[model samples]
Target: MLVYLRLLKESLSFAINALRNNKLRTLLSLLGVTIGIFSIIAVLAAVDSLDRKISKDLSSLDKNTIYLMKYCFGPSEIPQWKREQFPNVKYDEYISLKNSLTNTDQVAYQFFVNKETIKYDSKTVSDVNIVPASNEIVEIEGLNVDNGRFYTESESNSGTAVIVLGYDIAEGLFGGSEPVGKSIRLYGQRFTVIGVIAKQGAGFFGDSNDTSVYIPTNFLRRMYGDNDAMTPVIVLKPVKGVDMDAYKAQVAQKLRAIRGMKAGEMDNFFINVLSGFTDFIDGILGQMNVVGWVISGFSLLVGGFGIANIMFVSVKERTNLIGIQKSLGAKNRFILFQFLFEAVILSVIGGIIGLLLVWGISLALTQLLDFEFVLSLGNILLGTGISAIIGLISGILPAISAANLDPVEAIRTGM
Candidate 1:
């Protein structure tokens, strides 16, 4: 072990000297490895960051939460024309499910409506997301109220002219003043502000609650009279510890019965589960990973070739030294390991530089974009491991040739 440690030290020193003496050559040879490591690590870091953001955005909601809607969230066997023909989930269905579904924790009715402008005196905020939802949405979505409270079930059922403001919307319209009890105008009607949502930062999707205002779904129904353009969904949260498949089946059966579907007729509505959406995201991330690997693999191949070529040249240049060392009783294993270690050290240096570059850029991006760009420890380890493997594969043949050289023949050839 002591001898091997000494050999490693010598090999590292030799590698450093080679780099210093042949600066341009060494740089050119290592560039491929540096770029390769940078590409792979950067891609991995980006994907990891995206995954984290999605997880953070969805963390508050139960993965078992289900959305019953006319449209599917993911790819579906149902044709687009047929999907378009499916009737929108009505407020009545929401009420029926809320009262009838026994295996549920919470049920919510929500509407997807056109963007509307909101006004407070002279200050107007345009293109704000207007959410018309039942009072139960507050509990289903796990929303936090920074001030005031969400509208009650009575207010929702009565279609009262009351509104709940998101953090940004409240700040924009009311600034630092007390927004609760203040009135805001929407659709040419005045609505008294009843609550304000807590600040929720940027979301993975553009649907963060910060820029939204919520009112009773019945209010929209009353205003528009069941407009065809407005899409309504019934969101369900299943009871904890319940068999999800059984629960979904039960929900489906109930819906089918409520909708009056015949025994053999197909169900019109699509059931989109939160977990399925997450699985879809995972599939997309997996594809991105595969693409990153394929593109970066070419650069790594070139890097390996460059290292191999340099190692062979180094062997040729040091034939006489190898012969002398062999004559002095150095073993073949020592000679092989010496060269192998040198190659690995060189590759690792390049990989480290690449990793540092990635870290710096990631930090810059996080600051510039206000989105966290993560560089996990696992990815760093993966980069280092890949570099070492490349070095070993590239240096093997040259190391073996050097180790197997006949002392007299090597000396004669070098002279």
Candidate 2:
């Protein structure tokens, strides 16, 4: 073991010396490896950061939550034309489901509306997201109120002019002052501020509660009647520990009965599960990973070839030294390992440089974009492991050739 360690030390020294002696050649050879590692690790780190952020943003909600709507969240077998013609989920249907569905924990009604502006005196916040939802949305969405309280069921049912401001909206309108009990104008009507949501950072796909305001769904219904362009959806949370498939089946049956669908007729509405949306995200991530690997694989191939070429040249240059070492009782295994270790050391150096670059850029991005970019330990290990494997594959042939040299013939040829 000591002898092998000594060989390793000598090989490292030789590798460094080679780098110093042929600086341009070494740099050129390492460029491919460095770029490859950078491309792969950077892509992976970005994807991982995005995935984590999405999971954190969604952590408060139950994965078993179901969204019943006219349109699906992901791709569906139903034709787009047919989906477009499907009737929207109504408040009455939501009420029926809430009262009849025994397997559900909670049910809420919401309207998907366009961006609108809010006015508090002369201070106007434009293009703010407006969520018109039932009071049950507070429990279903796991909303946190930093001040006052969400509108009560009576307020929602009565279509009272009460609003819950998001963190940013409240700050924009009232600054450091208490926003609750203040009046805000929307759709040319005044509404009393009932609550303010706690601060929530950016969410996946730009959906954040920070710049939003929630009002009673019935208010919107009364303002525009049910024939407006707004899409109404029913959100349902299933009871814990219930069989999800069975629960979903029950939900579909109860909705079918309420909607008066015939036994053989197809259901008009789409049932989108939260877990299914997560699975769709996973699929997208998987595709990105595959593309990254394929593109980076080409760069690694070029790097492997460069290393192999340099190793062959090194063997040729050291023919006489190899012959002398063999004559002085050096074993073939030692000669082979010496060259192999040199290749590995060179590749590992390139990989380490790439990792450093990634770390620096990650820090810069986090600061500049106000988004976290993580470089996890597992990804660093993967980069190192991949580099070592490339080195081993690239060095085998050159090392074998050096180890098999005829001592006298190599000496004569060198001379």
On TM-score, the candidate that comes out on top is 2
Candidate 1, residues 1-415, lDDT tens digits: the string is 8998899999999999989988998898888888889989999999999999999999889999999999999999888988888999888888898899897889999999999999999999988999999998898889998899999999999899999999999999999999999988999999999999999888888868899899999998888877888889999998888898898888889999998999989989988999999999999999999999999999989988888888998999999999999989989999999999988988888888889999999999999987999999999999999988988888999999999999989888889
Q: How well is each residue in 1-415 modelled by candidate 2, as lDDT tens digits?
A: 9998999999999999999999999888888888889889988998999899989888888999999998899998888888888889888889988899987888999999999989999899999999999999999889999899999999999899999999999999999999999999999999999899999987776758898899999998898889658989999999899898998899889999998999999889888999999989989998998899999999999999888888898899999999999988898998999999999998888888888999999999999987899999999999998988888889999999999998888888789
How far off is residue 328 in model 1, in Å?
Answer: 2.3
Q: Output the TM-score of candidate 2.
A: 0.96
| Deviation from truth (RMSD, Å), model 2 | 1.5
Candidate 1: worst-modelled 10 consecutive residues by lDDT:
200-209
Report the error of model 1 at residue 205, Å.
0.9
CA shift at 275, candidate 2, in angstroms?
0.8
Q: Model 1 residue 8 lDDT? A: 91
- Among all windows of 10 consecutive residues in model 2, the one with the lowest summed lDDT is 202-211
